[model samples]
Target: MSGREPIVPLVRRFSPTLSPSDDESTDSEAVHPYLFGKNSSGWEVIEEKRRCVIIADAGAGKTHEMLARARYSAERGRYAFFIRIENIREAFASAFDVGDAESFEKWIGSEDDAWFFLDSVDEALLQDPLAFEEAMRAFAARIADARERAYIIISSRSYAWRARTDRQLLDQLLPYESPKANEIGEEEIEEAVQTGMSDPNKLTNSIDVVILDDLDEDDIRMFAAHLGASDIEEMMQEIKKAGLSSLSSRPYDLLGILTKWRSDRQLGGRLGYLKHSIAVQLDGINWTACSIDPSILPEAVGRIAASVILTGKAEIRVPGSANDERGFDPIEVLPDWPRENVVALLDCTLFTDAVYGVVRFRHRDIRELLAAEWFADQLANPERRAEIEAMLIREKYGERILTPRFRPMLPWLVLLDDRIRREVTAIRPEIAVEGGDVASLPVEERRSLFHSIVEQIAEGKDDRGARDNDAIARIAHADLSSDVAALVERHAENDDALFFLGRLVWQGQMTDCLPLLLDIARSRSRGLYARIAATRAVFTTGSKEQRDTLWDSLLEVPNKHA
Candidate 1:
């Protein structure tokens, strides 16, 4: 529905490895025979392979690749069956209900050579793992019994496959079972096992596994060229400087960046890009017929995004009329705005899905970022801020004070609102506050807060050491001199916490905290590792004197521990 053209992604093939939880010895390194042909046709890469399974992160172009492969095969006068795994059960049932393998083959015209591309196995896995397994087994059996007339290809998100103990399900689906005993020999089994086959007795060599690689520098340049961006190199430089390299590596995120860049020419961070992209879309709409004020449209959409994310629903259905009782009405959230106007605003943004009046953010990250923005806006009003704080600190649903999915949003939320930061700090004192008005607080109150946080760290009141580390970085970001000193003094004895603090200071370029880090590096009570970490932090902060002092301290410390 969005006018952007899809980009074909490069992929590499490897032997299927069991998940880390299942097999610790499984090779983590990617084994290859690269799958993408020079001409960008998968058919050329897998012509000799009978079965292939492609796994990738979400939005890494799995669906696009499958479609491209189907097109390429069709151009070569081969029949290709593109089945969305979401509808696999239905598709298989319709074709297989003819009763026997012969009838099924006739129904789908699979008697001739064909490519069966099953897209989004991850969706089926999530929707119903058992049904998915059963369908896959059935399909695999059909191919196995046939006279080798068809090739099967399946795709899934790598995380979905790894999270489920369904390795055997995949094994069963693969067209890799050995031929009849009369047709195969014992020596073949040994060869298969030697070549890293999952099951030696089965013809595992027939299956090829490929993982999609993230976009590299060349890919980014190609994408920029495709977008017809004049200052492509300049845009790439800005993207990296904004800490958006991770986003750029994913096709969908890269598209979002390019879209925003085209309109504004200045790319902010990830959230900023998303926000601006939404703005660009909204600006293109003709709002003359809308009853809602243009200024309030984003707030209304943000509320919908927040609601779905907070409630942990992919989509929320708003009633069409007053008598309808489908769910929470979007109209109720914004009393002044018409429901149609709110829906229109949502439909315009790339981040939201609004079909038949059911609305949700398109991606979890988009929902969380918008939700954070919504909370930031609400915090501007004192009453609304109190309500949000109350909701955050207490359980709104069974055993969930806040959804685990919302945890990543906390840092951004606090960064956007000083009041929310202070409240979060009060509730979880060991957590960090970024950009809070700590400098304006009364001296004794500031000291009391800092001391309490240090005591919490000393006693290990919060076992989530990562949160403490984030807090330390946040404090450094705020440049709270006293707070930094207190944290160093209290956490000096804990190597893990000290290392995290040092790394955060170094990464954040918190030069003001360099002196405090130097003191820790020179402290006799600290261990060698913690001292070394602090010394590294001092050196990274560009203080020559502190670096020299750290060198002296490192030498004076015991050599055995070093």
Candidate 2:
């Protein structure tokens, strides 16, 4: 009732088919040797057994085998659910148009005759290991009842499988050793990519299980043909020589290569040159290297996003005038992103529906990275300085007047010096002293400006007892809490300020300021503020007297609020 149902036990007698091995003998002349191989005999046993687990290393031909079995079962007119385990719950539910519990029951009908193909079981395990085990238990129970009528097939990365020793369901499967000449061909690949077989037993008579020893040979030959061309092909050869050939396996990398070639049509004219360019970029790193190598990609991607969002430039143009005798600057080579880092940065920048990709840190994470003190220190270099300055202007300050509300734009302003300068001219600007400059004004003048701005916005508003809600929210996130707090203290009975201060109190507990955070938390709310005060009192405040005072204060809040 909770999860998926158990597969029914096999009731009908089926031949005990053995998994094919070169040494194994076949009883039926009708069975295709290519399809079943040695395990051809095990088909009977597998069918009778009900549930099954198939384990193999990466590139071990598990997909080929799963396809073979799925095709066989489907041919028999049985409803076959071939699901990739990456999205197990959704996949199962969709198959039955039911929830998880109902899907399990459907798969584990009383008669016990269903085939479920699950690919990449590791994904489910990685997300939630407990649910995976529970699901397997339900599967095994149903398989026991269904016997020859029901079964489960699963494929997972061998490395992940080796990690969880407690999974008894897998321990029972105990994988068969991989064969020596283990290779899957185009025929098998095509069948898998297309729809699979319907009938398990009648497969041999219905379709040919063709096999070819060579798989990638045709793709290799096509590459050779492209290189034989005269023009662009030569460029491609150079790129290959430079090391770009290694990225073909990654879809994104391939897309990047094609996109780059398209943008530079002159280079595109020669196919060879394009290929060579790809080769040069991808030369040192292959798919495996991307997966296994220690990565600087995250940092690199952060830098790229920083350059774009902080600096107005897209990083795809030449930095300086080309007429100068200097060779093309490395930074100006256009789209000069570090290839290995693109994936990491892209992950952080692009927010999407949670179900499709890995969950990411909230938007605040990017803000924190950009606001790091290191970035502030490096702004002296023209490029770095330009990027940071542009970022501050775009994100923090705007034209016309100073905004009275503190929105944590200090994360931007913090990078610059204390003496904030005003632009003398809008058209072609130079720093100038003017009434517009917040930093240039004396303390009294600045406070008067701040108060006037607030009064103008709050005129005739019922919310005068507190700061603007939006303003308070912004203040709560300010980088320099002291400065923000000082600004708030200047106002009379600003409850919105207190509320914002409370949030900062909470954030501060997670950040640098801890001891003083309690004061801010307690200063905010009279009632539910008890929770925050209690947490602080228990963990941060040292003396029992302080704790008691805080607890009593919290207890008194309810009566007072009531």
Candidate 3:
């Protein structure tokens, strides 16, 4: 056996900090330690509950971490089944060589702690996400209804779940703005219907969620040490730079960043970081490698990804599958794309040969990022602008680029074309909440949208409660530009909406919201949660005199939520 130190990545439980409707009964829950050691505690945590969903950003090592943990569990004589969601059809088929249906049933009859690790929820079943949803529900049902005492774990990207991340884009998930019954125009009603659609968070709402935290500096240092870097101090210096902090924290990107940094090339944002990873592969460094031109790879892969994702398929192509009605040919995605160059990349580290001759990017996130980037960049050229834009925007609701598969392209498109952002926001306020910075928009429009968002957050709505909160949070960040004072007014004036606002202000003591919060704290009309949240928001950042004043004033109020 090759004896080497195993690096265990840190992970944490996903809390309900943003969920205002949560019940206050989580105190008895396991306080999952931020750090894990060589012992099997980290692995055991998965079985502590029946279902767990582990989420992280692209290339952050979700699959690797889960695999490592599963291996560790198996070595410890625990029952575990690792299933790549995409291959569920053949999962059990491939899971055994000697066992037939009878043997498998017998094995399951006696097995407990037969953990199932569903790799990526976003990529669970097929290239097409529609099929993925069906498979995901089936698996969820299996997990929920399993007679065996089995554990299940699924993972997904952050943006796939929420807009809090730096990489979030304009989401097409039907915004909180449901069309009022009084809308005068048919087109506007259609637009509202289109903007309001699905809420995916419900997919994992019943299961416990744990976010795999980004590797800290020490973790990065350990990784660098394993890579045999002699001057880690200087490497750490560069890593600490504001630009690379997020990049350095991710294992896959860290490897690429360090490898390229040694060459003394300047790296900037995600585009540069992701591009460099593929560049190293294209530099002819590994098996089945070619030193073909690196400039076109991103676009080649992007075009292919766009075609696949837009078509509602996993976007994977199965070669020589004319008889196999499941998918299409890779070359057909973009007729003008360089076929020879794209085909060359199909077998390299940058891409993987899925079962049979089917091909896809070795890294899924890279394909998505490049697809969005390529489409956005194409708009810069006058010749391709109309074709790309029209292909993206469709008359069908939630189809075309508006689908989740194309969510990555939303931010890029909005940023590239400001006028479209304004137009979409005018049609529906909630859609543009995720578009980008709110401070850049005109104040009057922002005020109008803010009111619309508040109206959208009306009491007793389940489908859009969280979406409305996210819209509010996005607008809250515009302390510099948006008219937040309007929110303090009888905007909905409902306890739920106020609690949502109080939670936002409580997040980090947004000082501008201090006065309104203090008022809410003293108001007898507000609900207990709303007032307590307002009180805590003040104590979190208010002066000693202000804190004491609020504390003393709250003497008569109940302490339930505080």
Clashes of each: 1, 70, 8
lDDT of 1 at 44: 60
RMSD to native for every prediction?
Answer: 10.7, 26.6, 12.7
Instruction: List model 3 lDDT by residue over 1-562, tens digit each.
Output: 1111235445522321222123543211211212211122244565564556675666678776776666666667666566666645434343221223343344466645466666665564225534445555445444443433566666765434332211111111101122345533655455435434143322222345566666778888888787776678777776544235655777777777777766654444445556666666655533243345566656766777677566644535554433243345776765654555445555556655444345555566566655666676777788987776566555566533333445544543454466555544444455555433343456666566666655665443222322422234445543422244446556425765566566556542467667777878887777766675667668776778777877688677566786
The CA lDDT at 527 in model 3 is 76
Candidate 2 residue-wise lDDT, 40-59, digit = tens:
23344544333444443222
What's the residue-level lDDT of 82 in candidate 2? Answer: 62
Q: Could you arrange the candidates by TM-score from highest to lowest?
A: 3, 1, 2
Best by TM-score: 3
CA lDDT for candidate 1: 0.57
Which candidate should be chosen as best, given lDDT against the real structure? 1
TM-score of each: 0.54, 0.28, 0.62
Question: Model 1: per-residue lDDT, tens digit, 219-281?
Answer: 888877876777998998987666566568777678788888887887765556767766766
TM-score of 2: 0.28
